[model samples]
Target: MQIVSTLRGLMLGLGISLAGAAAPAQAEMLDLEKDELKFGFIKLTDMAPLAIAYEKGYFEDEGLFVTLEPQANWKVLLDGVITGQLDGAHMLAGQPLAATIGFGTQAHIITPFSMDLNGNGITVSNEVWEMMKSHIPHENGKPVHPIKADALKPVIEKFRAEGKPFNMGMVFPVSTHNYELRYWLAAGGIHPGFYSEDNITGQIQAEALLSVTPPPQMPATLEAGTISGYCVGEPWNQQAVFKGIGVPVITDFEIWKNNPEKVFGITKEFADQYPNTTLAITKALIRAAKWLDENDNANRREAVEILARSQYVGADAEVIANSMTGTFEYEKGDKRAVPDFNVFYRYYATYPYLSDAVWYLTQMRRWGQITEHKSDDWYLDVAREVYRPDIYLEAARLVVEDGNAAEADFPWESDGFRAPQREFIDGITFDGRQPNAYLELFPIGLKGSQKIAQNAVVGG
Candidate 1:
């Protein structure tokens, strides 16, 4: 375990002087409803916010006691939140959007906090890496960073020529891992098929087959040659580097800068029933986020330790810190500094932007997961429902009012984002308000109410 002393200093320094301010006369005292709470998370490093909040006493400081539990799968985790077995969980940015639209399991779940950005990587087996290495251009015999998927194009073709299907793994269908992997492959001119609800064809006609593999089993699955490569969250991708079984080709930050990854999700009913508790939890999370990003990520090493405990992420501190401590390992012994790789606090990481929600909706429409096309207004309405910026603002206001945070720490005048972001590997600039125009930019997706049946010639 990498116990960074500097991180301790950073967290302690930023620790809020909540003792100074009294509960305001006008402020509503947080109704102490459901003081003891259970939250769920998959065993991924980005769940750091929840772990850090508990470990650093942030939760208790907000007059809330919380227990964190590891969930078996994404579906199970979502179900727990819906049924109130768990108040919330670390979730895919797409999960709430998918559920609200009746895609898989319809539920009215929403999020106010986006956990972090850009903490995923694509890794290939050592044998496959060697094959891919031949095509990649190098500078001074060192493999390039942000390696494109073009190099793997020929490898997949070779497997197809030999009558073998090229298979890859992602955490889940609606997961950021799946989309990031698809985006990387497609940007390199490799077609990663599509899904139409009406079409029973499980095959999306992808050039390289994509499937789901549990995070802990990713390395084993790759070692068994079941999957040539995979897109997954930390410690898993970093685990491959430690085992020397694989080399990470690209990080998601390289694919799309500052892409939204996970969210702290809760049902709308839960929020309405316990609004004060809701704000209290959000307050604790805000403090934890501050601790993580304070002093330019000096607290990450300590956070990695807390996440390593058996009750939380339960991974080795070294494994967790490999990516958590502002660096990532690709090939064995090839460690590089990637400061924003596992961001928890900076760049308003705690703020859940409506544009982030819209982006995920656009991806769903792009891939035919959303069977019908809707107008820009519809997109905004859905985004507004799921991504609660108003609630977040309220929480931030309370923390600031309580002297737990400075007024200068937040974006008081944030216009969601400065401009249309154009950093994607495909170079597509996405404007959140213009979903229809964005849909028109894609070459391989449905747009303008284009139905799957219309594209098929029955007798051909």
Candidate 2:
């Protein structure tokens, strides 16, 4: 790992102050148990925090040496962290929760920092878009924004009537893309499918079959006519528009406003073994997230350039800027100002809220990934185990003490839960404190004592 020799000199050259007026009288350095670390990530724009931390010397500011490597996919990245091949990785918000609950890979993964929010979109192939366009409301010769999946329901029905199965893509089974796409489809009265202990395929009783496609492969896969549409993170969704093969119908922000997306995940053993190192990593990530959202996103243009490099997201700067700069182009020329499209720090985004973890667990149970009902307290317990707000607050306090951030920037009194969120596309309310009751409101998912059996939902 390459260590920056003089972090103060680097900051000075960058023309940024290391201290603020509210900074403590003395800045303290942590005694890191581990300084040299390599982290992994997928090639998505939401990985910007990791890139910025390394490029802007945030890691060095904490006397740490770091390397960021892009992994092939979410599984490889998770496996890397579990096997100790990587210290940590940019992870799907669901990855750590699923891992901790022994869903996919049984490991005690914990997240100290949430990466970013609302950077994903659901896009359809040109043919499907043309079919759904007429169903969507229009104004001034353009499709209205937040095109509901109701428009796609008829299209899927048409496919079903013709004895053709509609297929869609998501990055992983436990990904936010899957849940968001499922949420959108079900809200529109389209059955996205379900998972069962007997059927891990998740396509049992489906209207649209959802499958996994790596982020970078989504556009090409759509173009190949393999899947009619997909839900994935930026530059890929924008890549489809740039390639003129598909049209993004709605962003995840429209599906659920300011939703928690990715996280900075490390193993529980790693945190226990190197407590200060974990705190340092979280501090650096918090700083990077703040930089990404600071000054009303004045730095996004620079962030786009950094993310466009070969080692980062590796997409064209223009493609990345389409969303990173706060305006998202949905249908080619239909660019709209979506300033909060990719929130990294604002609205307490970096804080690993326990409610965020509970939300994912609710989705897992709703879709049969949990295989059975769990108590609401069980959900909160798992969240408390995996989503470490204590570590996040400690890191935030240190960042404020260093004078790099203001004390007001962190949510000092949060009880690890946000107020009940009511912005879901279905207009359903989700209270993290009442996971089971929340699940009961969803019309198309497993709830209560319900479980999937023999390709049918049974025992409600």
Candidate 3:
């Protein structure tokens, strides 16, 4: 009778141990400075991390009740973040830097986490695609991908000969799309224009004139023939292919592999005043990003369904699934496998590296939006001011301690820069430490003591 009683106790102890091992560790919920919070996002598929966090209970796990609102446009979203109407928003990687530099609206904003990577594509209208088909190389009856703007050059020339302005659209003046489109166009011997203080049109000395159009309107605008082609985020790009109006010729992932995209931006004043709340929000976002990419994107199909809801992306589940499910559709019926098209956590996508900030600043300078020659150290200083890796690592540490994230997942020893990157479409290498020297590699853009004056590049 004594032996039987002892065996029963041992069995109970073993069961409890097994259950504890299987359960995920929960981090101690911080005392949030302000528990109920409001966040904003543009209606795009890359905003999935925000939606997933709210839906999958990551935000609730951190004892945060977050209200995710969709703003009308990027400008309104940035303004909301600035005016404290919104706690923080999903922001363009350039919005904070541009705001600090006083490009449009002057406000000091900072980002603690990068939202995702490589979720944009460049699409051209059907007429433009038809015109360029002969110029592009064909493989297995499909157009050769990473389609250079060189293929569209003759179309522009024909328009120029016929006295028609060749206009293309980008989401904003200081956007990754603007820079990537310019890079791809310039690489293919087409000028996508420049920005000058005197002329904010960004059409100085250009073969293809570029202008601004909001993301959701990209497809309708292209269909209406307001612009020939546009560069924007998904599933708008996929929306075009679905509507049979435009063809996505190239994705930003092909242009620049693993390029950083959106960010979770907040005011520095907000961070300083409510540090604990900031950490809590970042922790929830980090966990959401991990779930988006966990088990090799096992959760993406579910994510696509959530993002398809009206309050989030509001696009069809099928359209969102195209890129969200590790495949991308270029031309209609030309779906191809692109596994890294929407990277959330893999490759340290959430870590807001200072070097990534420097790259955007350099693009601003290269395109004359900065309007002054900034020193390399100036670039680093601005980067450190806006990109807060310290806050990110702190939040990451909390996640790690909870056993929710692996220690090897975060870059603990990084000096906040990736090694020099050389996978550009033009085959030029960019070292963040030498912003000016890196700018000089581009044959087309302004570099070193150069400024735009009177609708022309002057004083290099």
Candidate 4:
């Protein structure tokens, strides 16, 4: 009887031990400054990190209860963050820089994490595509990847000769789309022109006639034949391919490899006041980024489903998946695998490198959004102010300490990855540390102290 009783006790103890071993470690409870959080995003696939963080309970995991709202447009979203109507937002890669530099709205917006990469494409209307196609070199009966704007140069010149303006659309003046469109054009020896104090809005001195059109409105504007082509993020670009009304000539990835796209933006005041909350949000976003890129992007299909929900990108699953799930359609029925088309986690995409900030600043200067000729130090100072690596390091450290990620995730010893990147479609290498030298490389843009002429200002 005693032995049987002892045996029963031993079995019970073993069972308890097994149960304890099977349980997952409890994540550290983060103290959030604001629990009822309002976040904003545009209807784009790159906004997936925010959606995944919310839907996957990553924010909740960090003790944050967030409400995601879709904003009317980029300006509204930026204004929302600035006015405290929204706590933070998924912002254009250039927003923080522009805001800090007083380009559009003057505020101290900063980004600690880059949202995603390679999510934009340049789409041409059918008429423009038809004309440009003849000039594009073909290989094996397919248009070459990283198709340069050289093909479209003749088309623009033809329009010029016919006494008609060649207009193109970008989401906003400070958007990556605008700079990329200009970059591609300049690289192909087509002058996309400059903007200065004389042309503060950057619409003047135009050769290709670039202007702002919202992302959702891009396809419709193109379909209406109001614009010949556009540079915007997906699924608008993919929408063009699906509608068979336009063709995506090139991706921003081709414009510049793994280029910085969007950022998780918040005012510096908010971040300074709620340091813990800021880190917590960053932690959640880091998890979302990992999920997006883990297992060689095995989760992208699932991500597309979440983004398809009305609260998020609000686009069709197929439309989001066309680019998000490792494939892109240049023309209708010309879908090809482009695995790195939308990177979230890999290549340290989440890391807010100072150089990434400087690159955008360089574009601002090149196109005359930055009117004054600032030194390399001025550019670096602005970049460092807007791109807070301190906050990023804190968030990354917390993730590592929590064992959710490893030390191998970030650059432990470096000066912020400022190496000369040489994989652009134009084959131009950009060394962010050397802004003047980099600017001088481009023949079509303003270099050191170069200003636009009075005649260049259209409506100013």
For this target, which candidate reaches the highest TM-score against the unseen true structure? 2
Please provide TM-scores, in order, for all candidate models, with all chains considered together.
Answer: 0.91, 0.95, 0.94, 0.92
lDDT of 3 by residue, 1-460 (tens): 0001132245466775322221245755676688668899989998988988888777767766678889988999999999999999999999999998889999999999999999999999999999999999998899887788889999999999999999899998888899989989999989877888878888889899999999999999999999999999999999999999999999999899899999999999999989999998999899999999999999999999998888888899999999999999988999999999999999999999898999999988888898888889999999999999999999999989987899999999998999999888878888889999999988898998889888778886
lDDT of every predicted structure (CA atoms): 0.82, 0.91, 0.89, 0.85
Which parts of model 4 are misplaced by more than 4 Å? Answer: 1-24, 456-460
TM-score of 2: 0.95
Candidates 1 and 4, the one with greater lDDT: 4
Error of 4 at 239 (Å): 0.6
lDDT computed for candidate 2:
0.91
In order of TM-score, best first, we have: 2, 3, 4, 1
TM-score, candidate 4, is 0.92
- The segments of candidate 2 whose C-alpha lies over 4 angstroms from its true place after superposition are 1-26
Query: What are the RMSD figures for all models against the true structure?
Result: 5.6, 3.9, 8.3, 8.5
lDDT-superior candidate, 1 or 3? 3
Worst 10 residues of 2 by lDDT: 17-26
lDDT of 4 at 383: 89
* Residue-wise C-alpha lDDT for candidate 2, range 65-184, written one tens digit per residue: 787888999999999999999999999999999999988899999999999989999999999999999998999999987899999998999999999999999999999999999999
lDDT of 1 by residue, 1-460 (tens): 2111233344348894433222343244476577678898998988888888877767766656577888888989999998889888899999999899888899999998888888999999998899999998887778888789999999988989999988899988789998899889888888776777775332466788888888878989998999999999999999898888999989999999998899999998888888888888888888888888888888877888888887767878999899988888888888889989987767788888888888888888777788777889989999988988778888899989877788877777875643699998889888998989988887766678774554331111
Which residue pairs collide in model 3, if any?
Answer: none
